[model samples]
Target chain A: MPKHTIISVSDLNGALKDVVEDTFSDLWVEGEVSNFKAHTSGHLYFSLKDHQSQISCALWQFNRKYLFFTPRDGMKVLAHGALSLYPPRGTYSFVVKSMRPAGEGDLNLAFEALKQKLAAEGLFSTHKKQKLPRYPQRIGVITSETGAAIQDILRVIQYRFPMVHVLLIPVMVQGPGAAEEIARAIYQFNAQSDPIDVLLIGRGGGSIEDLWAFNEEVVARAIYHSTIPIISAVGHETDVTIADFVADVRAATPSNAAELATPDQREVLQIIANLRYTIKNRTLRKLEVEQERLRNLRGSYALNRPRMMLEEQLRRLIEIKRQLLRTTQLQVQQARTSLQLREGQLQQLDPNAPLKRGYVQVFRDQTLLLRANETHPQQLLTLRFLDGSVAVVVNEVSQDR
Target chain B: MSQRLSEHTFSEAIQSLEQIVRTLEQPVPLEEALSLYEEGLSLAHFCEARLQEAQLRIEKLSLQPSEVHPSTL
Candidate 1:
């Protein structure tokens, strides 16, 4: 029933695709980017729009590496690509092969200019930078709490050094108001009476413009004046910002910043263990030395000649005392026997015994004479027996052999 | 003297332990060495006790959008 030549939707789209692609291939289409989205495949999807109309654009990941700047919404850019068609939808889009920043600004130039100015002012001077604390107690982090920078930092820090206290002063890390917010955060931390040992100010990997806050003069100046040592970690490893130069130290990324901020607990524990071992060894050696000295002193006592001689002399004195005791015991036994014999003899000759046996003694003139020649005149005489006595005045004595 | 050592932190304990080891290396009198050995062992224990801790405390402060003070800038 169709009068004209009939074509399927796909056929017409394919025909149009070839025509449009051939004509518009490799042309410079100038427009403002809008509704931009980065797909997980490293491909960029966005709409380049003007006051009148908008066109969908796709910059594949391969082409994106050549881009001088990240194409954001409202950013003017000169995109080089060819038109393409999605046959199913019968729609056309620009497949951008290469792109560059255009109009109103160049981030690279601005970065260089600011860097020179700050360098001239000695903001990045090595002398001005403070040394980082070997062991940081509290680390003040100035970044977006919801960003990858915070997460990466926390994960790394928790792994390497979990004892550290992380104080996050959340701030805008992108677009408008990010620079001033970051600068104010630095000042706020500095104003505290108990300031943090170090400050980690940064964001995750981004385009230069996304990390533009770190390049701002205010942030650089704030870093320069901060009393607390600052570590600036902005964007990817290749992305260097002015804050990196002005900070006391610059890290390759957010995770690296956390690494630099802390001393590894493993190494610290090893050090402590080593010290314990060393002290134990040293103390044992000291005790051994003392023991050796005591042993030496004991050995020297055994070799002392005067002490040995005194010991020998004491042994002889003991022997001499034993001999003296034996001799004295024998002498006492003999003396007892001799005394017994003498006692028997003396008893036999006792005067009292003789009196009891009927013997008497006579006295004349108060004297007893054994000789007859001894005569007394008118002298008192006495005779004594066992129990009786008599008195007389006579003198007669007999001499007996 | 022993209270002070117990109260020392890991940093202080390690420093003092190092010093004690240095003193112990020399030939000290037995009475002095014995006391130093006691102190060194205690300091090492203090350092060990500190290693058992690994608590991560995170405090996040909120900031209003554009709450920056420009005058400081």
Candidate 2:
């Protein structure tokens, strides 16, 4: 490389940008705020200074919304962001993604770090969330008995779902041993011979320091490991704590936690009524189906009635009448045919039948003589013809021989 | 019919009643439907009795620091 080589200011700043951002990208800077100004575009421009040194800082609109408090000049704050450089101006600055007041700033950092660590361990996973009971008979509350949280929970539980027992395990909700006490209370409720349906562990609205017990790792771990579902209601709606993430449910207030724990009596009544309506309708439908089946069976079997039996018999009788008519007609036709045949046969047997044909047959008395030997000589005989009768006399009778 | 729910809690009774009603909404054999209706009616009765018998009992559980269970921490 040539020693005299030169580059544009943008190139020099660009080279410095990579070094600054990479070295100090993820770090927190503690200093007094100076020259704090918020742009109309929601970007925040400020300077962080100590007694000896100062640095320009910028908070983007995207990160400004995450700050719980506004930064003002002369406020001691901890600003966390990546160091960035503007190539055009050749100026380096800290882009503050989050800023908090100095005293609780460390706590906030620890809170965020623990939250991420626990999240990585699956403590905040939805799969590990316990199901809340729909109709909770026993609701366990762990808060200071003297606090308004207990009173609020009790009043709400009694007013909404009176058919419930509130087992209040009074525990210190703040200060040094408060987290340990709350954790013990949760475990005590879990180990009881009789189980509570849901546990509400919280205090009334408070400042972050006052609600610090809920952010303690012990409390969050207890909430995570408890077999019973827990509703975290440590502070006001905006003040979210680690217990809120660990618990099965998060309520904005103690009263809200009670509301979540139990069902309203009126709603329960409606559910029961709806179930009754369904059962009634279903049973009625079943009976109607059975009755329809019975009716159908009766219709098919109604031939057992005397009138139906008589109608069936009448139908059979008409069929018999038709058969009789047919049989009688055939018999009459046969009789007529047989009578004509007999008449023809009788005509052929007539003694005078041959007389009309110029052939004579003699009969003595009333006897029918079919042979000449049967006739007597000189005997008077009568011969019958088809139309008339005649008397004849045989002078001689002889055999053909 | 109370003996049928002797072992059930109030919530269990209500849950059973809900289940019975849901089951009855579908097609079931006649005998099974009759039995389910009977069971549901009894469960409903049990739940109603529980509602009437309910008393709001609030008990404060005060434990000393030493009384706290050791394994709980």
Best by DockQ: 2
| Residue A162 displacement (Å), model 2 | 0.8
Report the lDDT tens digits of candidate 2 across residue range A272-376.
Answer: 777777887798899789789878877774645877789889999999999999999999999999999999999999756677787655457878778988777
TM-score (chain A only) of candidate 1: 0.50
Which parts of model 2 are misplaced by more than 4 Å?
A: A1-102, A299-321, A337-401, B1-8, B22-32, B35-39, B66-73
**What is the lDDT for A8 in model 2?**
82
Error of 2 at A221 (Å): 1.2
lDDT of 1 by residue, A119-185 (tens): 8889989998899976676799999989999999999989887767788999989865577789888
Candidate 2 pairs with clashing backbones: A352-A384, A352-A385
**Per-residue lDDT over B1-73 for candidate 1, one digit per residue giving the tens place of the 0 to 100 score:** 3532333255567778788778877777777877877887787776666556667779887654444453534
Best by TM-score: 2
Where does candidate 1 stray beyond 4 Å?
A1-105, A296-401, B1-8, B22-36, B63-73
